[model samples]
Target: MRIAFYGSSLVSAYWNGAATYYRGLLRALADRGYAITFYEPDVYDRQKHRDIDPPDWCKVVVYEGTVEALKRVAAEAAKADIVVKASGVGFADDLLLQETMASAGPSTMKIFWDVDAPATLAELKAAPEHPLRRMLPSLDLVLTYGGGDPVVEDYRAIGARQCVPVYNAVDPQTHHPVPADPRFAADLAFLGNRLPDREARVEAFFVEPARRLWRRRFLLGGAGWHDKPLPPNVGYIGHVPTADHNAFNTTPSAVLNISRDSMAENGFSPATRVFEAAGAGACLITDAWEGIELFLTPGEEVLLARDGQDVVDLLAGLTPENASVIGERALRRVLAEHTYAHRASEVDRLFRNHARRVEAAE
Candidate 1:
């Protein structure tokens, strides 16, 4: 099978949050005998700060992100058996959706992968005349990274023929326990790109914990957060490289996962950090949200924090031995059930089922 995936970036995790998900899913598919062609815009500023390169399993194509460029890619993408236009491309997504759908041949399966389901669906509800209104129902499949029943229901209600949750998973081979880095060593660590919606959660979960436990050290790593005011206890390291994720997770006594506002409300939306931290065998503590236990058991495999005091209490009370046990259990669970290999196999089954349906219709 030939798969054409158009997303934010594959080689760099610069400001793009979906880079890890794209690389993990596509690389897994490639390893499973699918030939992949990834298309990204040159405007993402990621290629400049790229710390990683596309693997041999996939071919990358960069374009100027103009109407002419869209035309060129559409023609070439028509040859592929499966075409994916993921959300958060940060380019002309409306144009890309229209062009990709227009270019689709009868046999090709045009799928729209919504990495940011809450944001996308919210916009559609507020504005029904959005470009995706017409584009979505025409696509063969709609997949979301987060949001469980609500996301699926909304998509179907909005006229999507088929909608499914394709949640994020870890690539253990890429993210696993490594020796801690001295620079990142701390009592609690949080790594996430700072955005308006996420800043409040970060303050509540990450910074407030540091403030409450004044004696404990905290590490914050991400881009666009250097300007944000921080307390004396929290050490801010702007833009942690993708390659150092394991080291970052390992250095902290226990890592923290803070959801963006919408994601927390939507539930079942685990950020990439959840999987990455667990994969690195770090004792993980996250904010209270619905559907969390489905992915990681609270008492045995993970810790749930409702407020600053909860996180402070957990860090102060949790012994080294207890943290180690929790980390190990989390690693075991995600390695077994939450991995890109598992997601790739799920996609394969979905594709096979789609083929049967197409044949039946014919």
Candidate 2:
């Protein structure tokens, strides 16, 4: 199978958090002997600060995000077995969507891979006449990063012929347990790109906890958080690179996972951080959400906090032995059930089944 995927960035996590997901899943697909070509726009300063060098198995084609460029890639898009336009493709999403649809023949699987299903599904509900609604039925499939039952029902309700959740999973190879780095050693740590959807949650779950734990050290990593008013005990380390994710997760006493409002409301959705942190055997404490039990068993495998006070109390009360035990449990759970290899196999099976079904129908 030849898959042409258009996503935020494959080579650089930079400002694109989906880079890890892309790398893990695509590399797994390549391991299955599928030919994969990832198309990424050369914008958003990602091209300026290139992170990972060229990948070995797949061909990554970076193009200027212009109509002319889209036109040039139409033939290649048409030739592939699947052409996917991921949710947060930044600029030229609409342009690329239309051109990809135009180029894809009946044999090609025109897919919309929604990395942010909660946000996308919310918009579809809020806006009855969303352009995506008109396009959903025309596509071969819709894939999501998170969003359990509600996400699937809503997408189908909104005219999506097929809506599937491909929940975020761990790439054990890149995110397994590692020796701690003293520089990142902290009582608590949170790493996320600062966006409006998540800043308030950060303030409530992360920043406020820092305020209460005056004696304990906290570490903050990610871009756009340099100017936030944080507590004296909190140390903000701007933008920890993808290569250093294991060190960052392993170094902290307990790493924090805060979901955006849309995701929390939707339920059953875990962020990339959840798997990454747990993959490193880091003790995890996340804000309260409805469907988290599907991933981690709270109060046992993972810890839960309802608000600022809950986080503070947990941090203040936790012992090193208890934290280590919790981290180990979560790690075991993730490795057994959630891995990129598992997700990649699912994709392969789904596409194969779809192809076989089509052939039989004829």
Candidate 3:
């Protein structure tokens, strides 16, 4: 099948967190013999910070951020067997959502893939006249980046025909153990762009822990936070590129994963970094969330923390030998159960099955 997917930049991870998720899922889908075209806007300085050239697996259309350009792309996108508008496209998203759905043929599958379901859901609830809320009933299906049954139930409550959670998974080929780089050496490290919803959590889970443990090294990477004050022990590296992620992940004795407010409250939503760190065989410490055990076992494959104190406690007792053992165990679990190939198979099955159902109805 031919698929046209509209999302934030696929070639840039600069300020876009979903870049790896898009690459992994789409590349795997292409491997399964699907013709995929990804449409991304040339906004957010992402175009200048291109991480990878357009891959052979998918055709990427970098369009101007204007109504005329969007209309043209929407027309082209409507010709595909499936047309998708992923949440957080970062520019003219409401118009693109409407245009993509309106332009698609009757037989074409219309999907709204939400990369951040919790935040999206909250927005929909706050404004009944939201564009997606109005369009939900018309969509063929809703696919989520992560949010187990709760997200499915909520989307269904709002009028989705079908809602499925395609949680984040690691692309073993893209992320794996490599020689640790000295520049990233730290007892614990975190990589995420600073945002309002996440900054407080980062302070609670990452900064506070660093403040408590002055002797241990803590490295922070991602956009923003250049001026944000940090404890003397915590080192800030602004915006590590995708190419250096493997080194960043492997070098840290343990890496941290902190979710935004909505995701933490809703639970079951694992940030893409969780899988990326695990893929690189890094011992990971994640803030407590529901459905974590479904992905990695607590205290065995991963370390779970409820607050800054929990993070500090986990780090204090962590030995290099034990961290290595935990990292190895997490690596084995993810390789066996949570690879992009595995996720792509699930997505492929859903696409085929949905097609069959639509045909039968006709």
Give the candidates in order of TM-score, highest first. 3, 1, 2
lDDT of each: 0.88, 0.88, 0.94
Highest TM-score against the true fold, candidate: 3
Colliding residue pairs in candidate 3: none
When 1 and 3 are scored with TM-score, the better candidate is: 3
Cα lDDT, model 1, residue 162: 89
Regions more than 4 Å wrong, model 2: none
Off by over 4 Å in 3: none
TM-score of every candidate relative to the true structure: 0.98, 0.97, 0.99
Whole-model lDDT, candidate 3?
Answer: 0.94
Tell me the lDDT of candidate 2: 0.88
Per-residue alpha-carbon lDDT of candidate 2 for residues 254-319, written as tens digits (9 for 90 to 100): 999999899988888898999999999999999999988989999888999999999998998899
All models, RMSD in angstroms: 1.1, 1.2, 0.8
* Candidate number that wins on TM-score, 2 or 3: 3
